[model samples]
Structures are given as C-alpha cells and as structure tokens.
Target: MIGEELEVLYEVDSTNEFLKRNYRSFHDGAVVVAIKQTAGKGRFGRTWYSPEGGLWYSVLFKPKVHIGLHVYTKIFSVSIAEVLKKLKVKVTIKWPNDIYYEGKKLAGILAEAISENNRVVAIVVGVGINVNNNIPDELKDIGISLSQILKKKVKITYLLDEINKYAWHLLVTYRNEPENITKLWKKYLYPKEGAQIKFKHEGEVLEGTILKISDEAMYIDVGGKVHVVQSIHELVE
Candidate 1:
C-alpha cells in the first residue's frame, strides 16, 4: 500500500489509455488520477461525460494470476463499493461495473487489459463517480451524485482517499481469494433478489433473473432461460 505510486494529471484523454500506453515501463499498483477526461468512454464505446469535479481515475495492475479478464471488473466494482461504504455513503454495485444508490447509477467502471501469450500483461481499471458536481439535465433521470443524494456538496478529496485505501486493501486480499471479492460484489448488486431486469446480450434483447455470478459473468435466468453476459453495458427498461 505504501509502495503504490500515483500519477496525477490536470487533463487527459483517458487515464486508462495513458497507463496502457506505458504498461511495459511501470510496476504494478501504479495509478493515474485525472481531473478531467476529454475522451472518456465506458464499455462498447459508450461516451463517458467526465467533465470535472468527479473521480476520473484508473489503476494499473500486473497481476500474478491468469484469470479471465472479466474477473478484474468485478474486483473493481467490489473495491469501489467497499470504499464508499467506509465513507458512510450507502452504495451498491450493479452487475458488470455500475455502482448504485437507491437504484440509480452513482458510478461506473471500465476495465481494459492487454495480454501476451494468452496471459494478461496488465489491466487498467477506470472508474468514474459523480461526486461534488451538478448533474446534467439529461443525466438527472438516470444518474445521482453524492451531493444530490445528500443535499450538499461532498468533498472529492475525501472520496478519493477512501477509494485509494480500499483499493489497496482489495489488492492484497485478491492475491489470496479472488472469488471472495466477487462474493462481496454479489451482496451489493442491485435487483437484490427476485427483481425483474431487462438485459441485452449477443445482439438480442431479453429479461432475466440474476441467478448468480459464474465464470466471470452474470448467470441470468430469463423466462426460465439462462444466459451469460460478459458486460452489462446496455440495460433496457
């Protein structure tokens, strides 16, 4: 934890891109924190309106394990949830990479990895949280920030500290039991139990019961049917 390094930037296209470009040169646990992201994005090329006064950061990790790429995304979501919990903010994670409060999205994550010889060389987990900022008109319906939910401005620096502390704790814990992180992830996932959710996968739209997390994805049982999703980029009404 104490050995970790941070590279702060005033503005960047994307922290994930910055670290990925220099992955070979840096050691593990190096992080990039950006004040503003000009070309931020989520899964499936979706635009991420980072603006300012939000947490726009990514962690560079060189794990010793060869687990599938999706597991890291779960780790990130769980890490974020833990961090928020410590800050006294009630937070939960939606499957894949969304953090939720009262069923509205409070944060989102994007995980990118580079592999060589069928093994991951490095992984960049980019996280964006709506904190200490005004929600845009278009995002008001779909998103909520700490300030909006609490009816006051929340300190972004305090949130960043929480995130940094929990991330380091998760990193050490992950080395022992990767699935343990996933277990915590399942606990805070939205749609708690028996909640109906619309989902899209494999170019087809469907509805499903979130049966469980299996093999780095959600094992959704839809209409007595089962499907696996590697990413939850699109959730329909």
Candidate 2:
C-alpha cells in the first residue's frame, strides 16, 4: 500500500523536497519518482550524482509511533537491501544508510521528518539507486548499479514497485511489533562482526570492529578502546 499513488516526473531538484513541500495534499503512501534529480543529496549534504536512468524517489509515511528518524532509516534500508537480494544483487548496508555491494555503493536511503505545530506530521524517505546511470569516472571505484551488476538494463518500474511493497510491510511491522530494529539491520550489515572496519574517527582513520548496536549509537572497539558513534558519516565505508 506504500505506492497507492505513484507519481512519476521527468525531473526534479529533489524528490524529498517535492514531497515535503506537498505532503499535506497527498495521502500517506503517496510516492514521487523522478527520472532525473538535478540537486539530489545524501547524508551530510553531499551532492548525489542522480543523472538520467537512475531510480530516484521518495515516499511519504505517517506511522503510528513517533520513533527516531534513525529507526525509519534502518527499516527502509532493510527493505531496499532485501529487495536487491531477491534480484541476486547481494547488497549490504553500510551502517545506517548506504546500500553497498562488494564494497561499492549500490544505493543510498535518506529520511527527513516533516513537522507542523512543533509536532511531526509525516516522514519522507528517499532512495537513489544507480540502476543504469553511468558512474562518473572519479566515483567509479565507490559507485555501482543494477545494470552494471547484472550486465543488462533493469526495469525501473518493477524494481520500484517491489521495493515499495516490501518497505510498506516492514514499516507497518515496525509500528506494531515490539522488537529491536537494530537486530534486523544487523542481518545485512556490512563488514560483518569481527571484521576490520576503517572509518573516520576524530579526523583520523581508525581500524576497528563493531561490538554492539543500540538505538542511539554503535559501539566500536578500536585498539582496545570502545568508541560510541552516532553519525552515519563517520561509519560510511
């Protein structure tokens, strides 16, 4: 039911922005898909290279619980990863947001909360997938897509609908189930437990292993010292 009203546009500055700007006019499961995003962005305001042929879209949700934005992100990440896995893509999540395959980024999921009268009215979750777009030469080492992985063009419409169906189920389950969301994300977590992870820490690259995860932060063991990280930018590979 997540894509009750799927609206496709040829272009947009940002699907997330467009949805937030018109959330009041659309239903809870309304989605906006863009063929090209001129000014798309990822975590930390990094400019996303969303050229034509890529899958860029945002979904509007009004869940029953006022959970943290981070929880929504984790839920959506799993949704996207599971869908990709069904395509034999073998994608994994880089900590809290990015979807990676074989150490390269396959997709990125971002979420932002919409507020009204000091209360959240809706949350917009956006995903950008490099389906058939050509990865820039400079970013080729860090970027990937379905077309590149499958060696064939992918049906954007089919993939989009599948992701939405899975995401809707996960989001609804999260709303009703009294369970830890982190447990679910860990299933497809990158650099699996005890694996050496080199991430940005205090202006220095440190090698560590993820020891634990909580709703607020992840505990990493670096040189016998445990560090708590709450930012995804620091943990992204």
Name model 2 segments beyond 4 Å from true.
Answer: 178-180, 235-237
Candidate 2 residue-wise lDDT, 102-148, digit = tens: 98888998899999999998999999999989998999998888899
Clash number for candidate 1? 0
Off by over 4 Å in 1: 198-208, 215-217, 227-234
TM-score of each: 0.85, 0.91
What 10-residue stretch in candidate 2 is worst by lDDT? 173-182
Cα lDDT of model 1 by residue, 35-105, tens digit: 99999878788888887888888877787775555666776777778777766778877766788888678
For model 1, what is the alpha-carbon lDDT of residue 86?
66
